[model samples]
Target: MPKKALIAWGGWPGHTPEQSAKVVRSLLERNGFDVTLGEGTVMFADPKLASFDLIVPVITMSTIEKAELQNLVLAVRQGSGLGGFHGTMCDSFRSETDYQFMTGGQWVAHPGDIIDYTVAVTRPDDPITSGVSDFAYRSEQYYMHVDPGNEVLATTTFTDAHFPGIGGVVMPVVWKRRYGAGKVFYSALGHNADEFAVPEMALIVERGLVWAAR
Candidate 1:
């Protein structure tokens, strides 16, 4: 049987969750995954959440209930993969430290909002970033609070164009981690659906989904 994947999207429309969810669903489908698209935070409460091979949470900066958050954590710990990009994963569930712990990062700010920046692949041997070269990207150069334990695959440096006290700082752009038996993959890309068209950006996300699956 093909691997099953669940993509739950909603929360702030500013991130274009719905469109990005569709893009992710299509990519997984093309990769032969049996994909399910879910809406809102309620799906996190589903007892069957752990049954899937992977779960992609695309809700940005939304509040999840205690029970819902607990269930999601349990599911990941029990061995369901979690993968996402930009604010979809790292930026979601702001107040839930447990969620942050599981994913290994949280979005703090985008210094220059949308600007051109370089994404340097730090780990060329990693499956998610292999064969992909460093490239220029236009979007939010996310200044995040990331877990040092994360196996960082890509990074970007911050300049003093828009924010002070953060110049010349290097930030993780792509990382893969483990939460118990589950594999977690995250990329600080794709602020909107249009970014999915970027060859390098989309390739990383596609590879991440496959690499993240249980």
Candidate 2:
């Protein structure tokens, strides 16, 4: 049977969650996944959430009800893979520590807004980043508080031009981790669907999604 994937997208229109969802859905479908698309955190209330092979959240800065949040958490903890990019995964549910802990990071700032930056493939030997080289692009360079346990696949160095305190700090751009038996993947790239148009950026996220799926 083909892998099942669910994409729930909504919240902060500035991030273009819907357009991002379309990009992700197309990739998932092309990769032989049975994809389902929905809106908002309400989908998390589904009791069968754990049955899907993968769950992708394209939402940004939205509140999730405690019950819905708990359901999503239980699904991942019990082996449903969770994967996402940009503010959707990292910036969602800011008040929920458990969600942040599971996703492996939370966005804190994008100092220069849309700025030119380079993404370095830190784990070129890893399947999710293999054969991928460092690439430069103009977008929100997310400064996030990431989990120490994450297996970082990509990173970017912050320059003093924006935040002096964080200058010289290398931030994780892409990473994957294990939540119970589930695989969790995330990328700080992709503020918009256009960002994913970058061949390297698109490939990394596509491969990461497949790798994260159970």
Candidate 3:
């Protein structure tokens, strides 16, 4: 049987979680995974979620209950894969301490309008990023506060499009972390449906899901 995948999308509608999740869900299905989607706040409530092969959060930013967080974190630590992009996985949970720790980073600011930003792949030899050389997108340049020990897979340089980018900044755009025994893979792209709609971006997201699930 195909591996099970659950995508929980919530937080900000401006970022269009539901729509973006559909795109991601499709990508997973195309790769032969059994996928499902939950809207708004149901992610933290599903008790059986821990049994799934993967968890993909499309959330932007919000506070989550402590018990809910505990369950999710513990599930990942038990070996389930967790993967997603943008504020959903990284910049999310402004007020939640536990949530922030699991993600390995937080989006502190995005100086300019959601314009194109260039993403530079750091560890090109990694399975998720190896074949991908460099790609640029007209989206927000994520200024993140990252965890020091993460296995960084990709990064981006800040240009004049955003300030506080002083002398140029090299920020991790994609990374993986081991929380207990679980594998976490995150991509700082996919701010919208169109972002993941790109063939290359979609492939990246798909590979990330498969990689994390392993």
Rank by lDDT, highest first.
Answer: 2, 1, 3
Model 1 residue 94 CA deviation in Å: 0.7
Cand. 2 Cα-lDDT = 0.95
Q: Which stretches of candidate 3 lie over 4 Å from their true place?
A: none
- What residue runs in model 2 are displaced by over 4 Å at the alpha carbon? none
> What's the lDDT for all of these models?
0.94, 0.95, 0.81
Residue-level lDDT of model 3, residues 5-56, one tens digit each, is: 9998888887788898888888898888899788755576678878888998
Writing each residue's lDDT as its tens digit, candidate 2 over 1-214 gives 9999999999999999999999999999999999999999999999999999999999999999999999999999999999999999999999999999999999999999999999999999999999998999799999999999999999999999987888899999999999998999999999998888799989999999999999
On a 0 to 1 TM-score scale, where does candidate 3 land against the true structure?
0.93
The lowest-lDDT stretch of 10 consecutive residues in candidate 1 is 158-167
How big is the positional error of residue 78 in model 3, measured in Å on the Cα after superposition? Answer: 1.0
lDDT of 1 by residue, 8-126 (tens): 99988999999999999999999999999989889888889999999999999789999999999999999999999999999898999999999999999997689999999999998
Give Cα distance to truth, residue 102, candidate 3, Å. Answer: 0.9
Task: Report the backbone clash tally of model 1.
Answer: 0
